[model samples]
Target: MSRATPPSLPFPPHIHAWPDRSTLLADRELALTELHRHSLGVHRVLLLWLLALAAIIGWSLLVLPVQQFEERDPTGFLLGPVFALLGLASLSPSVIAVVLAVRRDHQIRQLLDAWLALDSAPVSDVRLRSPGLSLFWLLSSLAVAATGLWTSFGTAAGAQAGRSTYADVALDMGIGTILWLTGLIGVVKAVRHYRWALRTLGPVSTAGRR
Candidate 1:
């Protein structure tokens, strides 16, 4: 199908400069770089929630078992549920991150659509990704997924041992499931974005540089 050419229109209020095609692409490449950085930050934040999970689990391990074994102290019993509550509540951020990540992925697709729609778009010299960034995504995602897999089994074991309540198992297993899905999706997205970046943002040819 023949591509529809845009109508000649005056620059909107947001515009001040009329850049050539190459220049516009370069600017867009920079925008994509920033988006990539934002994505990394979001992923990091998502991972940080696990620390809260770990702390809650740690609190439970330290306080609950001792109370049960030693004296059935009501304080420990009370505090245990508090940590569980916090653990469950802390999932809010992970959920937010997931929402943001999903939205950002949509934004990325939209951005790519617009970027490609530009008149005679070509590769840009502006670098969008640093070396090892993709590797970081792959490794970190795999690690998180593995952690999720491990924790899910651990939660099940604890439940079998009667160490955890239904709520505890549910929350713990919920966290694991979220982590597992997020990590796997992250890895896939990293691979995808990396490929797109390479195809559309490679260093410009010498002839094209002129």
Candidate 2:
């Protein structure tokens, strides 16, 4: 039987050229390592759908009817479970994203450590920073944080002024907190990465590679 070669990885670029063939092997290996996490980029979205299904199934099969199955009171059986379901539906996305972000950060740090130990020279050639994406993330996060601040405090102000109901204010605050924390975390993570890259990557600190 004839031997077969694996197809090349999907590399994103308009023009393709590798000028220096000397470090190509190391560079390819680095790309493959990065690709491992990038592969999760879209697949992780399935988690949202999975969570939604879980919520629905849990509500239908367990929550709705199982509450004092013999009890005849509708309020006890329905109202409490409905509110809990609503809470889960509202909060699960943020919880899931936070978990994923933490996991990804760990994976990235592990990769960097492995590369540092191996003295991977290819790290120098590629620009590890994505300026455009980074800019978008920073700006978008700030916008979200700003909106959240308004929603959080502005709603309270309205409620105190008798312009809004307590229940309405509580809902708004819940939403605002999620947005505020998410945006703040994004901003902090970006800053942390910048500082870390500065200290670890170029000339500030010594890595085995560069």
Candidate 3:
């Protein structure tokens, strides 16, 4: 009887079998690089989110002392619903991010299963990171809220005294200036980043469609 030999396995063209000693080290390094990249993206998203939240909280606190509710008149009732809606709207992106993160985690799991089964794995598209949409929403909400607060409170305060003091004028000016500056900065940054991301990601999208 002739001795039987094992048949060689075929792999996809993109996959290469490394020599025994190099295999472990090479794969570990590749995984490390991937993990590092993912970490950086997560870090950036978190940083921008926290910065936006902080700015909102800070601006709200600064204006809280100056808010006068009495002279707000008929529009006063709208504040409750407006703020509630703003809260809901502002939460949308965070919720979307969480859902995407969860979905990506599931995809990673699926990819790992394919890898372990020695099957060809699908490539993941790296999404272009931009804080543009979130920044826009944040700025818009802040602007509306800040403007409402100023209008309502300033009117109420001014109605009582019928005159604006230097201190009152200075405080009002300072708050308005800060809110405007922050909103403008956010808008500028968001637009620039968004444009860049769109341009950069356009080719990626086209390749994906093919």
Determine which window of 10 residues in candidate 2 has minimal summed lDDT. Answer: 1-10
By lDDT, the best candidate is 1
What's the CA RMSD for each of the models?
Answer: 8.5, 9.6, 15.3
Error of 3 at 84 (Å): 37
lDDT (C-alpha, whole model) for all candidates: 0.56, 0.52, 0.43
Score every model by TM-score: 0.56, 0.59, 0.34
For candidate 1, the 10 contiguous residues with the lowest summed lDDT are 1-10
- Mind sharing the TM-score for model 3? 0.34
Residue 82 shift from truth in candidate 3, angstroms: 39
lDDT sort, best first: 1, 2, 3
Weakest ten-residue segment in model 3 by summed lDDT: 1-10
Model 1 pairs whose backbones collide: none
Q: Which residue ranges in model 1 land beyond 4 Å of their true spot?
A: 1-26, 40-73, 76-89, 119-131, 154-175, 194-210
Tens digit per residue, CA lDDT, model 1, 45-158: 455456445544543443444444355566766676665566445555556656665676667555544544443333342344444766777777788788888888888876
TM-score of model 2 (CA atoms): 0.59
